[model samples]
Target: MRKPCWFLAPPVSRAARWRGRCCTGGWRVRALVRDPFSAGAAALAARGAELVVGTFEDRAAMRSAMAGVDGVFSVQPSSPGGTVTDEQEVRYGITIADLAVECG
Candidate 1:
């Protein structure tokens, strides 16, 4: 059987759409969400996604979320949104990429 694909963002974002597509395509999905109880996360769960509560800043959570997954869809908030600076966004992307490799 194919391993799960990990999504590194909340289901409310673009990840939600991709998650649905993945589900329909017969791929198991695992999402890293900040709040598992949120409506978006709940919707994802209803659609068969395994939700892991974490943010990009949480290395341990990211590692845990990536465990045993076949691949990852890395997504991070960019600058001007104020959630993260441009440098931080780049760093988060790189970090997720590195972790995906390490997990493999």
Candidate 2:
């Protein structure tokens, strides 16, 4: 069976590389993003990622995205600005990890 991979808030650079790998049948890639219509998300989809519309804080979305996932690559925002504080970022990361464990 093909290994399924999930990418959380994947940046363009890493997404691009992963997309290439997925195209070559390396593994199945599911990209989780807040906005699926965004240009970056569109690009990832165009390259072969199965887009999972979601945010770090959305538990339902995270759970749905992580179902049957073999591995996960979380890429959260670096600067905790705009409504998100450092503590919130940590919480979001923990939430993702927790959901991964729960789903697995």
Top candidate on lDDT is 1
Q: 1-104 in candidate 2: lDDT tens per residue?
A: 47678867545555466556664676778888778889988877886778888778789988988899888877666564576678877888888888889998
Q: Please state the error at residue 33 of candidate 1 in Å.
A: 0.3
Segments in model 1 whose C-alpha atoms lie over 4 Å from true places: 10-12, 79-81
Total backbone clashes of model 1? Answer: 0
The lDDT of model 2 is 0.76
- lDDT of candidates 1 onward, in order: 0.83, 0.76
Q: Give the clash count for each candidate.
A: 0, 0
Error of 2 at 1 (Å): 6.1
lDDT, candidate 1, residue 29? 85
User: Tens digits of per-residue lDDT for model 1 on 1-104?
Assistant: 47899887644566567778876678888888898898888888988888888888899999998999989987687658676789998999999999999999
